[model samples]
Structure formats: structure tokens, C-alpha cells
Target: MALLYNHLRDARIEWNRHQPQGGETEDEAEARAAAYNEKRRLKTVQSSRKSNKLNMRKKVAQKMVKLCFAKKDEEGVAAWTWFLKLLTELGNAGMSSEESEVGDMPTNSGALASVVVFAIRRCPWRLAMVNKYMEQIDEAALVVLTSGHSKHARVRTEQESEKFPPSGLPRAMYNPAWLTVQKTFLPDIEEILNFSEGSFTMMEVEVVIPGVN
Candidate 1:
């Protein structure tokens, strides 16, 4: 849970931690250091090996360039175009320690709709974007994001699709957003996760629209 100190416009964070009391003399600490070094030498070598592999992964990501574009009202062509560019940047940073939080409407797309409404009422772009897009989306090319928890065994099932008939099983949350979706077809909630984004997580969503609209 998160709380906001409205007056300060800041969020208060709570977490559990263990505190350490310090009272070690320099000589006492030095004596332990020598023994620690002997044990740490091999561990350091192994850690470096892991770091090397991560570096290689980063290099591999640099070569991948998947560009997906969403068309908005002609006025928002640029914003839609920018969204695709942003995805490419995120792909490049795949090796970094950035974590995304995705939310699903498993409990109720209505609840998800409520959150969307709240966001739109407070900041309306594609005010009714989700419902609107889901009403018309293609499920075939849809990407899915599943829960990280093992309750579902880390698999994102296709439960039911709203987009098109063929879709990927659940994976993990990607990013969702309010798009200038036209009324054509509907995709399953799971299949359309990649189409939206609230900082790269499926659960956390953000819908965009033209500034003037």
C-alpha cells in the first residue's frame, strides 16, 4: 500500500529492515578481514563470471529492433509514433535493473475499468480507452503478461480472449495505454496487455490522447 502526504506532495514508504549496531574496534575488524578475503576470492571470481554473461546479454539486446506503432487520431500521430520508439529504448535496457509492475483485471475488468475511469476523470485522454479498445482489437498478434507469482505456475493462460481467436498464453505484464483504437474487433484482456503501458507493466496502465482532445 502507498500513502501520499498531500501537503508535501510526497509518498511515505514503509518496509521491514534489520538494523545493525556498530561497536567494533579497528584491530578486531582487521583480524576478520583476512579470513573473509580467503573465502571471498572464489566468490568474487564467480560473481565476475556472472557479470560477464550479463554484459553479453546486453550486447545481444542492442541488435534487436522491434518497432510497433499505434495510430491515434491524426492529431496524435506523433505521440503514437513516439510510443513505438520508447519500446525500442526499453528493449535496449533489458539488461538493466528496471522492474515493471503490471496489474490485471482478473478480479474484474470492471475494477480495471474503475481505475481507468478514475484516471480519466482525473486526467481524461482516451477516457474510456480500455473498454473502447477491448471492444475492437486483434488478438492474433497480441502479447501477454502473466503473474510473476507461482500460484498459476508462472504461466499466463489465455483464459478467454477479447482481441482475436489465436493469442499467446499469459506471461508477465508488459505495458498498456489508452490508444486511439477504432471499433473493429475485440481481443481477450490477456492478449491486449502489450498494447497499453503504465511504465512497462500490464497491471499499471496509462492511456494517452491528443493534448487538445
Candidate 2:
């Protein structure tokens, strides 16, 4: 009899846990349940965001592989166009890394180090293009730095505009001021240019260290 009474008491307690409390009206019970569900929903969203952050490096690496290894020609208009596209993608990927960091955004130095390491792994041969793109970024960053505004139309005269190549795309399309993953990883950019196509294996080991970012 005691065991059956205890079982009944436990079942009653379990039922009451989900039911409205002694003084709670139907409206009050509904509001309380809604608040709890909202909290659970917010927690789910936060968990998903954290998961995305953890996967960022893997995602960026895969994208770099796709960009670097495709069968595009190595010279002329096709190559130039492909190279430009690759640069834009690299900058975008780096920007994504920055977005993960949120409140305390990393400096270009740290973020660039991480991205340069990633770039070298996926596409060492075209890594040299980083220098050219960096120059374009420097031009754009200069304009923004000096002017105190974000507008892009300040490139004065026709002669002065000659700094950007006629055949090339705009600095905005290429360097994109927000891409701190680095338009150019400064220290290694010149060194990367010196790597012979076959010599990258040894040089990569020396230059691409882990965890710099």
C-alpha cells in the first residue's frame, strides 16, 4: 500500500510540474510557457552560430581548393580573369573569418597571417598575385585613409588614374577595404613571388606556420 501511495505521489508531482501553478491564470500560464520557449529558441540559434564558427576554417580551405585547382589557363585573358576572381574570393573568405570574431575584430596582421597560410596551402603558384592585389589595396586604402570618407570617386585626373590598369577591374572589386584577411600578407608577399613553381613545397614549410592568427 505504501509503495503504491509513493508511486501515485510521484506521478502527481510530475503532472503538476507542467501544469499552471496554484495562483496562475490561463493567460499567465501561456505567457510563462511562451517565455520559456523563446529562451530555448534563442539558445538553439546561439548553438548554430557557434557551430558555424567552428567550421569556418574547413569551409575556407575547401573553397580555396576549388578556386585554385580548377582547369583554367595559366596566362592571358582567361588566367587574368580567373586570378581576379580568386583574389576576390580570398578576400571574401577572409572577411568571413573576421565576422566570426565579432566584438574584438583582429588586426590585419593576425588575420592576414591566418589567410596567407591558408592561401599558400591551396594555391602556392598563384600566391604571387597577392602582391599585385596588395598594391591595388594600398591605393584604395590610401584614398580612404587620407580622405576620411568611404567614397570611391576621388581618383582625380586622367593621368593620375593611370595607376590602375585599363584592362584590370576596379580597386573596390579587387581589394575591398573590409577584407582584412589581407589583400597582401606583407612579410611573405615578396618572398612568395620568388618561389619557383616546383620549389614551393620547401618554401611553404618554412613560411606557413600554424596558429599565427
Candidate 1: C-alpha lDDT: 0.29
TM-score of 2: 0.25
| Stretches of model 2 off by over 4 angstroms after superposition | 1-18, 62-213
Give the candidate number with the greatest TM-score. Answer: 2
Per-residue alpha-carbon lDDT of candidate 1 for residues 1-213, written as tens digits (9 for 90 to 100): 234355334322111111111665666555555556665775565345335424433322222112112332342333333333433433321111211124343443445421111011111212233223221111111221122211211222323222221122122212234222322234444545333333432222233322211
Candidate 2 residues 95-180, lDDT tens each? 21111221232465765222211111111222334434333332433322333323222211212111211112233233333223
Looking at model 1, how many pairs of residues clash? Answer: 25
Best candidate according to lDDT: 2
lDDT of 1 at 190: 50
TM-scores for all candidates?
Answer: 0.19, 0.25
